[model samples]
Target: MANIVIIGGGPAGYESAYVADSLGASVTLIDYDAPGGACVHYDCVPSKAFIASSEVVSNTRHADDLGIRMPSPDEITVDAPQVYNRVKELARAQLADVTAGLAKTKVTVVRGRGRLLATEEHGSHPVEITPEGEPAYTVEADVVLLATGASPRVLPGAEPDGERILNWRQVYDLPELPSKLIIIGSGVTGAEFANAYTEMGVEVTLIASRDRVLPHEDGDAARLLEDSFTRRGMTILTHGRAKTVQNTGDGVRVELADGRVIEGSHCLMTVGSVPNTTDLGIEEAGVEVDDGGFIKVDRVSRTSVSGVYAAGDVTGVLMLASVAAMQGRIAMWHALGEAVAPLQLKTVSSNIFTHPEIATVGIGEKTIDDRDMDVRSVTMPLRTNARAKMAELDDGFVKLYARPTTGVVIGGVVVAPHASELIMPITLAVRQRLTVQQIASTFTIYPSISGSISEAARRLIEHDDLD
Candidate 1:
């Protein structure tokens, strides 16, 4: 059996471990934390748990709108401590589940920080593992996969104090919810937290450098979310760039580049993320990295050095957990001499978890316009759907893009509650290169938000027939 050693226990590492072991490879996984890495311990899992709690709070507040007469809706309040506890509990449970799954596999789990040692003359790679408060040891492997994930980017003069001024990872440690929360950056992380806190009854101020939030996402989706945030009393400061943040012992103050100062009970910074590639012996291993310190890898996840592969946020390819897992699997498949296809980034689907979620797959409208491709597009508003009107949701739409002549579905965007779930069929259509007629002919439950996706595809088919 081939010997494999993977560094970093995130989705990339563990998922690859499973694949390698199942493929008759002896795998050793070195992880800094639990098997799930930062996603489970700090980011994705815990944050989603917090969002779920906030969504409940939001739904209860709007119960009257749904015609559910309640005795005292105003009396509903979020227990901040309880919410944090629950988030932590959910993260722990996920970690336990991941650890248990690894135990069932033959892959050996090592707790430590791992770095690449100089390649041996026999062509076997050696990985030096340094366990915290323990002596360092080296493990030789026929193949080595680097999956060290990324960390939250910290701005100059705005370091997280873990008290008042905070980063996304530090929010769960908050003792009490702030009366007013100031979120810096209007990207996915920033928008998600701003929406969650606002729903949880905290007055939120979102600072966006762009004209609208989620500048990289679909324009219509961003506009709908921005409007929803404003209607819910969340203050959005567009075209505002935060220069510095100061924790004044009690509250936090943020200074903008355009000579503006904003104060709030707490400040959360969601600027971006930096790949955790420092001191991993990239130069020693002769691995090439980009100017931003991200390891340069091709679609097959091969680094500059042969037998040494990289995946996940370390490779800076999309940075989603699902993408990380796929990259990891591809690397193992290639290394183990299994048939593998290169990663197709265009077919990858993504979602922004906001109040009304925005999910997208395949090509975007901007890409079509930039390339001036011959594409036909159609949009169906959720307000026209029977289920949406019955649920009192009027703020989202399903958009489909197809080839003008062949009518094959190339891309789609959905903005609505549970858009993540609703985008699956559209994602399948894009991935399989299914035609508009195929999606239109597929039966979607009547009165469902997903029905809008089919309706949009039907409109595209009709447009194609007209031509």
Candidate 2:
């Protein structure tokens, strides 16, 4: 049995540790925090729970339009703390389950700061870990999996104090709701919180450096989201980069590059992430890292230094929690000489948890823009469908792209309420390379949002009428 040492107890590290332990390997998992990682304790579960409360508020407000009356007097309002408490409760429950699973697998959890100790005088080559306040655990392991995750990147001028100014993870701590919230950097995380908070009755102003929100998403989809958010009283300022963020006596002030300034009760920055790869003695171990401080790893997640591997946000792989988990699993399998497939980024699916959500997978329009592939596509509006009419949803659609010559599905985009769930069928098609004809033939409930999936594929199959 080989000894496995994993650093960072986030989704990536804990998942891999459990897998390694199940495979009969002796494992030691080290994390400064609890076993659930940032995703559980701060990022994923907590954020989604807060978003769920926002969903409730939105649904309550829209109930009358759906002919479903809520008889609560004086109109329903937000309870930020209770909502936040609910988020914490859910996170705790999920963390409990995850920790329970790790226990069952017999994975040893070490709580402390873990640093690599050099075996040689030059401080080069294989590693021995020096844990905080404990004996120097000289781990002579068959393999060391580096699953250390990342943290929210703080732009130089916009530092967060976790009070009036904060990042995504710190928002839940506010005792009360901000009367006005100014959100800078309208990327995926930024857009998501903006939408959720606005729905929960916070006046939100979104500041973006680009021309549109979610600049990384499909152009049309981004435009649609901008329109939708605007309709919901969200003030969007594209091309307005935040130059300086300062706390005023009443609230926070953001001076933009364009000379205009805005103020709000709180400023939340969601610029992006920085990989947590430094100070782990990776460089001393001869492992290569990119200029951006992300560890360099091969398709199989192997680093330049043998017996050392890295995965997840630290490697700068796709930053999704799911992708991080998969990379961690693949790393363990490879290091243990089990069956493994080289990482294929193209097939991974990710979703934005915005109202009228966006989810996608496989070959994208960006990749196909310059190629000579025989691609055909169809965009079918949800408003035109039976289910959408029943639900009274004004925004969303199913867009599918396929290889015309081979009839194989290549890419797809779904924009709908619960679009995340609806995109599963399209994801399966693209991953399996199933043709538009096959997707069209699949059965779907007539009064369901997923019917748009088949309808969009059918439209692509009959392209002559589209023009």
Candidate 3:
């Protein structure tokens, strides 16, 4: 059996180990933290736990809207400590489950950081493992997979002190909720935090360098989210970039480039992420990284070196955890001479966890317009759907895209409560190249939000005929 060594125990590395092991390869997975990576330990799992609690708070506050009586509006309160504890607990449980699975799969787990050694140093073995407080060792590998993941991007002046100023990962460690929270960068991360905190009754201010929040998302979806944030009394600073963050005795101050200074009890930075590729001896091993320090990998996750491969956020190719796992599996399969398929980015679905979630799948409008592709689209409001009305959900919509002539679904966007759940059918349609007629003809439960999807698909078919 071939020996496969994977660096970094994030989704990509851990998943790659399992795949290779199942295929009869001897695999060793190495990382400092528990196996699940940042998605479980920091970003996805923990944040979603907080979001879920906030959702309950939101639902209770709006219970009166559904003719359900509560004791009083003022009496409803969210315990911040409990919320933090819950997030931590869930993250720990998830990490435990992942590590347990890795153990069961017979993949050797190395508890330390792994780095590519100099070609000469790795005369026989290409990788070196340095465990904390332990002697260093080398691994003889038939193939080396790099899944080092990424870290939160920090501005030069806006350094996180982990107290008054924070990164997304540090927010979960707060002892108590801030009276006023300032979030820098209004991308998906910033917007989700803003939405979650607003629901949990924390005053929030969003700093957006762009004209609107989630500038990369669909225009209509961004506008809807902005409107919701405004309705919830969250302050927004647009077209202004955050220059620096400084602790001011009791709180923190954010200085904007436009001669504006904002004060908040705490600030959360959601700018972006930097790949964890530095000091890994990648260049020494003949692996190529881009100008941004991200590993340059092909669709199958092969690095510049024939026996070396890379995946996940380290590759700077779609930073989603699911994509990381898929890329890792593809890398191992390709290396093991097993059947493999290159990644098709357009088929991937991503979700933003906000009060009214935003989920998108397949090609977006910008891509189609840039490619000059002929397509037709139709959008149906969730408010118009029976289930949405019954649940008192009046915001958001379902938008579908299809080829003008063939009626093949190409992409879709959903904005609604549990929009993530509703986007799967649309994602399947896009991935399977299902026609608008086929989607419309599929059976949908009566009075469901999913019915809106089918209804939108039917409308797309009608509009295509008219064009």
Best by lDDT: 1
TM-score of 2: 0.95
Tens digits of per-residue lDDT for model 3, 1-467: 89888989999999999999999999989898778888999988999999999899899989999899985756878888889999999999999999889879979998888888755544333688888789998877878999989999999999999999999999977889999999999998999999999988899999999899999999889999999999989999999898889998789999999999999999999999999987788977888889999999999999888788999999999899999999999999999999888999999999999979999999888888789988788889988999999999998999998887788889999999898888899889988998988988899999899999999987876773633
- Cα lDDT listed for each candidate: 0.91, 0.84, 0.90
Candidate 2 Cα lDDT to native = 0.84
- The TM-scores of all predictions, comma-separated, are 0.98, 0.95, 0.97
Residue 444 displacement (Å), model 2: 1.2
How do the residues 64-94 of candidate 1 rate in per-residue lDDT, one tens digit apiece?
A: 8888976464577889999999999999999
lDDT of 2 at 401: 83
Q: For candidate 1, which ten residues in a row score worst on lDDT?
A: 458-467
- Which structure is stronger by TM-score: 2 or 3? 3
Ranking by lDDT: 1, 3, 2
Count steric clashes of candidate 1: 0
